[model samples]
Target chain A: MEILNRTKKEGDRTLLDDLAQKELSRRKFLRFSGMAGASALVISGVGLTGCVRDDDGSGTDGVNLGSGDIGILNYAYALEQLEAAFYTQVMATPYSGMNALEGEYLKDIRDHEIAHREFFKAALGTSAIQGLDVDFSSINFSSRDSVLATAKAFEDLGVAAYNGAGKLLVSADYLTLAGKIVSVEARHAALIRDLISNGSFADLASLAPLGANTANALDGALNPPQVLAIASTYVRNRIIANNLPTS
Target chain B: MNVHNLLHEIENVDPEVYDRLDSRRKVMKRFSFIGKTLALAAVPSALGSMFNKAYGQTNDDVKDVLLFAYLLENLEAEFYKGVVGTFAAIGVPAGPAQGALTVIRDHEVAHVAFLKTVLNSLGVTPPVYTAASFDFTGGNGSRMGPFAAAASNYGVMLAVAQTFEDTGVRAYKGQAPRLINNNDVLTAALQIHAVEARHASHIRQMRRNLASGSLVPAGVTLQPWITLAQSGIDTGNAGANAAIQMSYAGEEVVSQATVPITNIGGAVISANEASEAFDEPLTKAQVTAIVDPFVV
Candidate 1:
């Protein structure tokens, strides 16, 4: 993960800057309003039901993530679609020096991801969103470094997405299903991390600090906006998550 | 006094009593209907009570659930600490493998400290069990559990490591439903949950890399991703095998919520693939049963 520097096309800050900019601006206005003795009118800018966003770009440009458990399922399904597509490409174009063992493991991961993708598609039934349009042109699949690096990014992102989204589900079954799937993502993340660098399976940057001490923080728990920002770069289809939970 | 007899006498005394009683009964009926509706509508809090007996809380509360999580972190922390403490004796040579154990140990320690902070913030006293409290040997001071021999062997220690990490992953998942309404806590638990999964995966990988020896069980795929019962931990002995199975009883669950996942889209997914794709959660009883031996 790129370190936050408040300006860059790096992964961490892109989406957050857009979303947080709005939130911060709202706070500023309210603070100014409070000074003028209009304090009683302080309204919450974003809510847990979902954040308000204007990124639909006329509906077809991006996917509108719906409300409640269905929206959450759509979110998971979108991720699986991206993963399945990416791995399909990885296998289709093996990286240089990729061994038979790596191929076999990558194929297994690819299949599991496909199964998850189909599971959500079926579970969502008609409620499922359209297949996401993935843009892998930026990826250099022929290079081991780029392929594994991308794999690590996707796996880590998938794990964090599930971690943060698990709570937004109103249905216990959805939460359980998310739990069932997320750990597998975690396993893949570790394997990919090892492939990239052996020892740092759960790297420090992925740990979202609950407090100042690193011990109190959890590894790889990016909220929706932060995850989507990194994910949306590869995803050609716009992903709208207005209905997803905020809190 | 019998209310039935009193009502009967009152009915005989006044002819208009019957009409009055009927009106009162109708009002009571309305109240009962509304009461039933409200009760049915309050499922989340009721879901909260299923954990009450475990934590000694009245009605719905997450404190007991958090305490159970505290116990799990404690269990994992102590297991790793014991292995790190007995590194050379356990045949863990000074290398990356040993360093991996230290990483596992440190993560568990962090988890413990993190959970304790949450518990303290909630105004509930966290459990005071320390690394010294648990006897990971599972031998009540005798140090003779089937896994005891493995504790000293690096390869077998990896097996035990897999067991603890796998159990931790599922235990967090099992307890997640009770904390579903508490998103902050749920998010934190899940954050720890995946880290445990990463640990489990690497530990399995460590075992897979072992030289083909007595320690490596024959005829099993030792791939890092769990594939139901193809797990390399099967030692063929009944007691140890039972322990392994206990940690994995629900891992092969093809059922999601209530229905079969294979039934979705009428997809003909193999049971192995279906089960391997999704990790299952262990119930409180199931998890406790698996971890009880190491508890002391």
Candidate 2:
């Protein structure tokens, strides 16, 4: 009990002093805590004492998206990587009967996804996770219906992932960035839905598979666990996201 | 000495004591734990300070964000109401186009109600406004502006609707940072924000379809996503009606977080693609400047 109290006090003082003197960003502080290890674990109150298994190059246990803002960023990066890869494949092998406009738009989507993926990777810098290997075996790229259906799924999932992850962000700047990206994702979702069926965009009732609520007319928001569960199907590697901040 | 009695006493001094705490049950559980840990005399002061640390301060930033969201929703709800009312006059066919507009109008109304409920829960009496409070013609209620024909022409109505929906998405994105402290509110705002984006995309699709003379066009110059700040709506002769351009102002950003997005990872991303990759946020002042002309 004495050791616990002392550890808690020291952790609190270190955090408060750093906040007062340096005005450190949450991401910086989280990185600092990651280095501090056990002491920082107490500060987070998760009660775990040991190094969090983040990108340790151990493939057996999967990639553990650490905690706090960085974890969320990595989570987002993983999704973007998946999207970029999928769209790249879509463009490389256009679906049958794809007109000039559809071909142009799909290529545009591929470029946008690449841009988003690169943006997250650069923003995360050294903390960014490795490029995820996706499994697109289920998607029939030659079939328009199959490709459009998959695109709609990924777009909706991306929107929900960002929406669910928004509240978990501690930095206002990061929150705003996520906001900027999520709406674009929503726009993509709408466009894809329209491509499948005209006037079906924003029709939440039909998107029950994605957890959309028709009553509220609000888009669905899936937590990290829920998002990862669906993303795992296409994402070959296991993404351990247990440490993402819930509050 | 009883936890309930202590709460009752605190309630007399501060009527919103319960609201400040998580809940009565949680308070009782926490106080019981504290009762066993500390001496009985230390309970009141300890509880007081605990409450102070927990929920003593009200966040005016969050309130301001909510209020702004409510106002935007009201503006959109009114605009949609007008569109729905004059669908036939505006040449909006009685099929998918009209149906899409109606769905968007309902969503705006729902967002307004949701925000109003949230404000009321926070003890704020949200200002009540209706179609009377807005000018859909962008003439500040004069009803004689560039978009005056918006009520009678399908093309004009779709343009104005597209502008409003796109602006709504940006406006909501701008305020998301303010609501970060309140997780539930942030999530709710995001849900609405995405819906606005969906609305914007559909409106853009509608405009493109109308132009191509088909319910679903094979190819559209105006993609669902904003490309290089192009409004896809007319700016009048020689861009005389440039006030509407403010809605797309600063949307051509090709960089994010100081990272040049156009050329990354050895791949050349076009400036237009980079801009369309991520939607930019508008400040409150910027959004107000764009919307003020239409607001009375």
TM-scores for all predictions: 0.77, 0.80
Error of 1 at B256 (Å): 3.1
Candidate 2: which stretches are off by over 4 Å?
Answer: A1-59, A208-211, B1-58, B212-220, B237-240
lDDT of 1 by residue, A201-229 (tens): 87655444311124653766766777888
Worst lDDT window (10 residues) for model 2 chain B?
Answer: B22-31
Q: How far in Å is the alpha carbon of B167 misplaced in model 2? A: 0.7
Could you say which candidate leads in DockQ? 2
Q: What tens digits encode model 2's per-residue C-alpha lDDT throughout A95-214?
A: 899988788878888898899899887776545677777899999999999999999999999999999999887666678788888998898899989889988889888665666667
Candidates' C-alpha lDDT: 0.70, 0.76
Candidate 1's docking class is acceptable
Worst 10 residues of 1 chain B by lDDT: B22-31
Fnat scores for every prediction: 0.59, 0.73
